[model samples]
Target: MKKIEDDIRKIEEEISETKIILPYGVMSITLFDLEQYEKIIVNINREREKNQNLEFRKSLIKKYKFVFLSKKRKLNKILNNLKNNKVEFVPKIESVVNKEYLQKFHTYREDISLKENSRYFLRQRINCCINKVNEELFLLNFHPSLYMNSMDEYIGGDFRYRYDAEAIIYEDVNILQSESHHFAIYTNEKTKEKTKRDILNILAYLNGTPIFLFTQNPSFNRKIDDLYQQFDLLDMLRLRKNEYFKEETEESISLQLPILKNYNNYSVVLFKTLKHAEIVDLYHSSLKQFEPLPRCVFLYRVFEYAASVDYKVKIRPTEYKQEDAIEYYIEKAIGYNPNPLYYMDFGSRKVTNYFTKLKLEARKIFKEWSEHPYKKSKTRGEIIYNIGRNLVAHGGNGEHNMKYDYDKNYKHINDVNIILELIARYVIELLNPGLKNVVERRKIYYEKQYTL
Candidate 1:
């Protein structure tokens, strides 16, 4: 058993190093053993009838039958084959990477045009010290792998969830060079997270797209109890294109093309960059005159204030069984003094309606990200954000399992970003005071409720 495990590990290491020149390179198909293979086919056929992706479905069935079928059997007894050994102990890998279904780009790897090379992409601004190290880092595969050999302009990765888009030496770039003594590899796990965050931020920046992080570092998984500086988060979030505005809201007139819909196709939570030029196009050319960082600085301060108050103290009521007592306190606190820290900087007189509006935007974004099927319109996203903001503001409670899930954390990161940027815009307007009536246009759901 040990020898087999060691051999498997060695193979995985070798496979990790091999560059996947995808859409052009061959894909391995079928992984599970014979009995499990038959069961998978049976399970797939059941699901295949439900989805509208018939062509994709048919291709899978054909591929599974031809190559994956280790011991041949008639099609009729597939359900019977699945009946026994239902208790799955260990699911083995099947070489089921079907190329025909995965590949998208028209051009081959070597065939590239000069125009694509000049594509406007965001770049990572790495510091001098960390930039000097030579160790392999990767972008965790958050979405389906895109084809087209644009490694000069973009990075290529395996067509699997959480595969590393490896960091390699490219044109003698100092950051890409591999060194024996990488700082992240040697450091105690807690300190290694900053390095891990930097790598993902750089890749996400360069792509001008949201790239998720999944690294060997244990610190990232441990879940910190207090507020700490995350690596270049604001810059990465800014790259997501027109994130707040939805397709319908923009009155966008374009036909939606059906992407290669297969088993691997997943939902996207995008982060885009809005260039100064894009800001001029979407909102106003006047915004170009005001600097971006000042707004970001103010927003950072807002987070500092949110963390100051103790919103997590859930005391029981004296009179009765207080299962819902914490809920009562939270409701009262938000209605009376939603965020005391928020009022400190911008006086209530000047920014009365603005804070209310910010909460509404956070709720809206939160709802969209959460996709919670069951309805609860009463506790809107804004209220939830305020509560979370207060709880998180107090440096997050690690004890009593106050930690957040991965998906929820990612959604919150994006949602809070939307709230902060919107507020920043209003703050900038406040400084000028020239656009009083115009800035009022940013008002949404909350001010209607709070701002009398």
Candidate 2:
């Protein structure tokens, strides 16, 4: 009876050891935490280097490789969730080899003839939540007394409103008496960047008016709080490529209903034809500036836009191509010395005299350019671009004889300011000729009214 008990005790010890003999040698499976798996692999590698037995190495590889591969797949599953930023419960490394993962590894390790077919299925169901969110968000850009005929019209996906439910006229935050109208665009885009881009594109169409301020409010649902946003004036100004002037009030332009309505139609055509839409926004915004420096920069942009399209403007490496284009356009379209009254007329003597002075000073500046290396002819382009535009744009660090000083060059830039506006208007008309007749009639009407 004592001998039988000893035999049973020896059998139990053998079972606990889990020793198996292969063609190479004896191997044992040690029950340890998953953290020790790396040490086991290292030991195997160290032993492999010492043992030159080919069959021994093959046996070790066949036995351990299957278990290593299974554990690696399970570990990757946990890592993938973390990589994708998903919150999930992960098993501790100590518990992995002692628990569920260990059982799977043991099943594969123990069964040398085990045939496992791993089939993985990954499915994604995209939720179409368009209807659940606000389908359209509208940005209302406000400007003072736009003089647009009261008309609520939908143009393609973008909607324009003079007075409507969505386009409510808001009182100017700074000025009490001054009320402002808006050109609103409705789109499904929710991101702030996309909304701003859409607003800019629509504002490009309203080049006839000055749009400096805007507000965005999107309501996804009534139950939740809405997001209200406004683009800060300083932030928008900072985005400008060249320096710009900021004024409290916009210098509003008055146009008849038919003329203003045609702006809508002409904008549609311009959107398709105008390759560089940024120049359009820059041109119109320059008109409302209190200072002249920004206007001069915009005037140069006008010439650049003209130069890009008109092949007749001879391109020279040393010469300013924009200035050349400006000269070419003025001479071809409205003569070198264009009368201010031909484009717009003011009832006030002071305003009228200011414009008259602008034209005379332009001629004087033209003569000054004769001494320049290029010696450009006495044209509107010569004074506006080569002289005024260059002085403000290039004059930095108090250089160019301190020409960048606003007070110092006020007279020169102010004169350039008036001429540039007219030139900008002329170029715009030249490019978008659809509203040319209407503009001409309005100019004639203003001229007659001022004369009377």
Candidate 3:
């Protein structure tokens, strides 16, 4: 058997010692009142779908008032229930060493409030997916109810929506080597989609830093919730070198995933399951010129290379291999340090082909965005922290000193990592155009919501 991770052991110890308490003093789940809580949950979820008013939803929060007892305090009651034939009982193995895995089921809680109950379905789906992967779960996360996070960071641009999702993170000491560590992160749908990408960036965080190992792909199986594999940087760059050589269309049933549409009261079971398939297609198609990477990934890479040259941060490739060919290729693919041989063999061609396409596509994207009526340039107040408030140029253009928002012009430059993220499917959708089938299918399920 694999050795239990030490951090996980400590966390399990803490959980066992502390009696859990939900927000707003909603009594803990230590004891069941001999009622099927699932039925109550179903009813609550139903009302949430039908209702839309924010106040009404807030009012529903105070409904759960059941008193709960600790496992030890409730043990005699459980035995009495079994004695009276109210329930079936099983004997506990007192001699066995106590640990979380030793327990039959590990129940975790998210927000006990009614406001975000819809996410429970998403969590259930993620849980189901994890169960399929067969890895021993180490830690699980649930949402916090009643209290929205007190985030003090600056909010510059308006978002489509801001939401934080609850997820489970598994800690493994060393799946590959004695020195290396591994962690698996699983979220309930939208949690993976952060509204505002920060300066610190997503990849830098998910690289298994602070807690565990390096992340390559950070992508999961759409059909089955498997651990995200590291994106093969070398392989992806080589594809770039080859002008995005793509494999022939090989659609299979396993690629299909049922999409959730809130119109069906947010049902995951799709009547037509090709929504994910077509999305997978569109996402891949957008990156065909770059290969095995997303549109944003290629866009960022191109931007990085271009800026590196302009700002003189760029290092020209040279041939200096400390070891063998494979190791050399791996280093070259990482693109941190470069040599002339790398450029001649791969970089020169990739850069040329990539820049050519990027120039054309970026122009079109800019034109469309500039012409859109409802579109507001989300660049205002972006440089609020700048000494000049907004960067200013005292050229005295027409009359007074000209106001130049240098930050807006240098948005990507100001933030070196503007859109870094795990190459997950939900993330892919955020970058790619929606496929026709997926778009059309969305109409049936996005029933107009009356609820907030």
Highest TM-score scorer? 2
How many residue pairs in model 3 have overlapping backbones? 16
lDDT of 3 at 351: 15
Relative to the true structure, how large is the alpha-carbon lDDT of every model? 0.29, 0.37, 0.25
Clashes of each: 22, 0, 16
Among these predicted structures, which one has the highest lDDT?
A: 2
| Preferred candidate (lDDT higher): 2 or 3 | 2
RMSD of 1: 25.9
Off by over 4 Å in 1: 1-378, 381-388, 399-406, 434-452
Residue 190 shift from truth in candidate 3, angstroms: 15
- State candidate 3's TM-score: 0.23
* Clashes by residue pair, model 2: none
For each candidate in turn, the TM-score is: 0.20, 0.37, 0.23
